[model samples]
Target: MPLDEPAALAEGSSRLPTLEFALTGSTADYLIHASPDLLSKARAFEHWESTRLAHGLLPFARSLQTPPAAHTTLREQDGRDVRGLNFSSQDYLALSSHPAVVAAAQEAMARFGVHSAGSSVLAGNVGDGVALEQALADFLGLPHVLLFPTGWAAGFGVIKGLVRPDDHVVMDVLAHNCLQTGARAATRHVHLHRHLDVDHARRLLTRIRRNDPHNGIMLITEGCFSMDADSPDLAALQALAQEFQALLVVDVAHDLGAMGPNGQGQIGLQGLHGQIDVVIGAFSKSFASNGGFVAGRSRALKEYLRYFAATATFSNALSPLQIAVIHQSLKIVRSVEGEWRREQLMQAVQALRQALTQEGLTVWGQASPIVPVLLGDERRARLAVREMGQRHLLANLVEFPAVPRHRARLRMQVMSSHTAEDAQQAAATVAAALAASAQLMPQAAQTP
Candidate 1:
C-alpha cells in the first residue's frame, strides 16, 4: 500500500506525532504495526516480500551522512565515512555550491528571515518571490506563472485544479508519479500511451475527443523522463493537442534547468515556447533551489491557477531565501558560463554511457544525463549496488514498482562537476562490482 493511504492504525491510539520520526524494523513491520489491514490485503506482493527476505542474505542500504553533492562522502549505518565519487546527485549544473547563488540566499535570509509562514493566498509572497515568478515568465516567454512549494505538488495540484470528473487526461505511461497521482485524483477517465510514443498519444487523444468532444481533454507528458533519461517530441505533441482541441501540459522537472539552448529545456530545444499550452517545472534540479512553477500562455489562466490550484493556494509559497537562490541561479543559467557547464555535463554523460556499454551492460535510452544500467535480475541488481558501495562509488538502485522488476537498474546521474576521469573510473568500478555481484548471486541464493 502507498504510505499515504489510510492504514489500520491502532484504534484509540493517539495520532502519530507529526513532528516525530516513525521508525520500524522493516516494511512488513511498519505495515503490521501501522496498518495491519492494508498489509493483509497486500499479501499478493510476492516481489516485495522476496526482496525483503533477500536483504538479510546480502548487504544493502548504505547510509549517506551528507547532503547530495558531486563527490560527497557517504557513511555506513554505524557512522563510518565511505570515501567515494557520487553519481547519485541531480545537481547537473554544479550550481549548488556556486558562490553567487549561495550569497543571494544568505542575503535573502538576513533581510527577509527564513519561513514564509503563510500560504500565498494569505500573505506568503515574501521578498522577491513575485519578482522571481515574473522573471521566469519573461525567460520562458509565457504570459504568466504561478509557483508551488515542490515539483510534486505543482504537478499534482495543477491537474486536480484544472480538470473535472468528466474530463479526460491522456498521459504517457511513464509519466512521473506525481503527474499520475494528480490525473487520477482529478478525473476517472484517464488514458495512458506508451512512453514517448507520439503516435500512440495522438490516437488516444483522438479517440477521447471523439467521445467527449465538449469535455476538457489534457494531453500530458514530460520534457524529460527522469528514470529513462529520454525526451518526447514536444512539437509533435503540440500539433496533436492543437488538432484535438486539448491542452498540452509538459512537465519539464528533470530537464528544464539542465538541457537545451540557454537551458530553456525540451520545449526550447523544440522551439515550442509559445506553442505549448502549459509548462510545469521544478527549481530543484539545476537551479540550486526548492519549489516549482506552472507557466501558462495567458494571464487569465495563470490567475485562475493561483486561486484554484490547491497546492499553491493552500501550501506556503517559496521561502525568500529559496526565491533569491532561484533568482540568482536563473541569471547564471542564462549566461555563457551556464552553457559551458552544460557542455561539460554532456561530455561526462556520453563518456560514461560509452564506457558502461563496452562493459557488456545494457544501457537504457538516448542520452540527456540520466543513465540507467539495466541489471534485469533484482537479486543481482541489489548485490551490485552493495558491491559498488563497497568500492566507494555511490549511485541509486531503482527497483520493482519504480520500474518493472525485470528492468531493475542502477540510475546514475552525471553532473557538470564530474570530470572525464571521474566518469571513466566510476564506470570501471561499476562494471567490476556488477561482475563480483553476479559471481556471488548463486551462492547467495543457495545459502537460505
Candidate 2:
C-alpha cells in the first residue's frame, strides 16, 4: 500500500496525526524485551516500523537512483524519484567518480577479475593487496599495516585480536559503534569517559592502573566523529596511555584523506604523526573504495593480527580491484591534487556551516566535512526530514540511539565537488523545512 501523503502545508495548524503517532515511541523502545519468544520481539518491531512506513516517516534504507554526486536522485518509499542537492554520501574528496580512480579500477578488474576468492591469510593476498598495505603504512607513517574487509572490521579486529579477556578498555563515550562493540567483545572491563574530556579519561586510566596494573589497557578514540564532527585531544590521550603503560588506538575513518595538511588526518594535524600506538582507517570515506586497515609501529604486531584477527583470518580479503582503486586514491591524496581537493572540501564545509548558521540553524562542531544541524525534538526532526524530502533536499536524519533521545539532527556530509551555490541552496531548503515543520505543529502534545 502507498504511504499516506503528508498533510498540506498550513500556518499554525495542529500536529498531523502521522507525525504525532511517530513521536509516541522510538527504536530504543523495542531494543529490549521481557518476552522470551524471539519471534514475538520481531513481530512487535515490525508493527512499529510498518506504522512509520505508512506515515512516510521511515527515512532509513533510501535507494540512490543515480550516482551519489553533489546533485543526485533518490527513490522514495512510494516509488517516486526525488532529485535534490545531495549531502548524504560520504565521498568526502569526491574521488569515487574521478577519471584516474575509475581507470585504475577498470585496469584492476581486467587483470584480476572481481573476487579475491579466499581470506588474506589463504589465497586472497594478491600482489596488489600487499602493495596497497605497504603504501598505506608509508602514508600513515607507521612501519606495518594489516588489511581488513571493512573499517568496522578493522576497528573490531584490532581490539578483539590483541586485547585479552582480562584486559581493560578506556574509550570515549561518543566513539563509533564498531569500536564500542569491539571493546565489549574483547573484555567486560570497558570504561567510557565523557566525550572529548581528557581529564575524565585520565581519571579512568588512573583507576584502572591502580586496580590491575598487570593486565593490558587499550585506549580508543576517533580522529573525527562522523555524527558530531568533533575530535578528542589525541596528544593528551597518548600521554595518558604512556603514563599508564597502555596502548592508544585512534580510528581515522572520517578524516583520513579528507583533512589535514598532507591528508594524514587529525593525527598529523595534532602533530602526533607516526607516534600513535595504533591507527585504524577506512577507505569508503575518501579513498573511493570499501576496505580498512590497522597500522602500527611493530612488524610483529602486524603478523600477529594477520593470524589472530578473526575478521581478517576468517573473512575474505579485499579484492584486487578495491586495492588498486585505494592505491590510486592514496597516490592522489599525497599529491598536490589531493591538497587542492582537501582545500576545496574544507571550503565547502565552511560555506555550508556558515550558510546554515546564517539561516539561524544550530550547527555542531568546528569546520569539517560533516555539518550536523541540531534539531532538539525527535518529532520535530522527523517532520523536518519529511519536509526536506518534499523540498528536494537530501540529507540523513540521525536520532535516538545514535545520539541522545531529544538531540536528533540532520547529518549533512559535504564533498569537494559541492559548489558554494550548493551550500547556499541546502541551507535555504533546510531553513524552509524547519519552518514548515514548526508551522504544521505550533504546539506539541505529550506523546504516550
Candidate 3:
C-alpha cells in the first residue's frame, strides 16, 4: 500500500507501465498533505493500493494529457500536433471556440476581473451571474435555477442538500459518479436498478414505498447515459415517480444542449418539460462553458439549495467570463443557428454510427451525439485506442469499472463542427484500428 509497491508489484510485465510519483514515501508519510489525520493517510494509501493493479495494467487511459481544442481535431498525447478527429471532448455543439462566445468572454473579462474571488453566497455573486441564472431558468422554462462551479457539483450538491439520511434514493446503476457519491453520502438507503430498466425501477420503488411510505424518496437518473449513450424511458420513469410519490432528478448534462428542438434535450424530446420535479444539467457539454445549474418549479427550492448545498455555498461561483460565455452560448443554442448545429451534430453521429455498424461493430443507444462502439475485450479496447491515436483519430477508451468488465468500449462524441467527411474518416479509422488491435491482443486479459 505504499507508493513504491506498484512499481515493485508491476515488475517486468511489459504490459504494465510504471508510475512515478513525486512523493517518495507511503501515503501515511503525507498525512500533512491535506489533513493532519493518520486515518485519512491510511485510507488514502488503501485507495491507491486498490487501483494499483489497474494502474499497472492500463496506464494509458489515465496518462497525463491536454486537449487543445473543441473541434474534431486535437493534439496527440506525445506532444505532437495531429489532425486527428477528436471524439473525446464533451463539447457536443462545438460552441466553445465560436467567435461570438469568445468575444463575449473577452469583453466580460475586460469589464470584470477573471475570478469571482468569493463564494456565490457572498461577494462572488455578480450581476451578470444573476442574469445568467435567470436566462437559464427562462431557457429551461423552469421557475428557479441555482448555479454551481461544475456539473458534477450540481448533481452532488442537490442530493446532499435535499436528501436526509432517513430518505431513500433509487438511482440507475449507470448514473453519474457524482450522483452516486451524493446518494451514498446523503442517505442510508440507496437502491440501484439495472440501467434503463424502468420496470425494475418500478419494482424497487414499489418495495421501498411499501416499506417506508412516509419518508422522502428520490428517483435519480440522467437525461442521457454518458457511457452507454442510451436514454431511459423518461415518460415511464415519470409515471413511476408519480405512482410512488417520489421526486425525480434527471441530470441532462449530455443531451440538454445538443439534442431536441431548440436544444431542450431529453425532457423536451419526451414532451415532459416543466413536469419533472427537478432538472439538472451542465454547461460543459452543450453550453460550451464551465459550471452546472439545477432548476425546479419553486423559488423556495432554489433558495433552500443556495443555503444548504455545501458545494455551492462553500465554493466560488462561476467566473464573470464563464457566466458571460454561458449566457452567449445559451443565446446561440436557442437561435436558428443552434438548431442547424444540432442537425449537423446528429447527422455526424448517425453517419458514424452507421459506418461503424456497417463495419460489423456494435454501436449502442438511440440517436445522440455520443456513439459508443462496444469492445468487450479490455486488451483489444486499449490496443484500439492506441492504434486509433496512431492513425490520427482520438477516441476515448472506457473500460471497467466505468462499464462492466466485459463491456469495455470506445466512447466517441460527435461534434457539430465535424463534417460528413470527418465522420466517415473517423469511422474508417476506427474500423481499421479495431482490426489491427485484434491482431495485437491475441488473448484477452483474464478477469481480475
Q: Which residue pairs of candidate 2 clash?
A: none
Tell me, by lDDT, which candidate is best.
2
> Sorted on lDDT, highest at the top, how do the candidates line up?
2, 3, 1
lDDT of 1 by residue, 25-56 (tens): 12433343444467543542333333343442
Local lDDT at 29 for model 2? 66
Window of ten residues with lowest summed lDDT in model 3: 17-26
Q: Estimated TM-score per prediction?
A: 0.87, 0.94, 0.86
Clashes of each: 0, 0, 1
Which run of 10 residues does model 2 get worst, by summed lDDT? 1-10
Span of ten consecutive residues with least summed lDDT in model 1:
17-26
Cα lDDT for residue 209, candidate 1: 79
| Alpha-carbon lDDT, every model | 0.80, 0.88, 0.81
Q: What is the lDDT of residue 215 in candidate 2?
A: 98
Write one digit per residue (lDDT tens) for candidate 2, span 261-286. 79999999999889999999899999
Model 3 bad stretches (over 4 Å):
1-83, 442-448
What ranges in model 2 sit over 4 Å off?
1-19, 442-448
Shift in Å, residue 32, candidate 2 = 1.5
Question: What are the RMSD figures for all models against the true structure?
Answer: 6.3, 5.1, 5.4
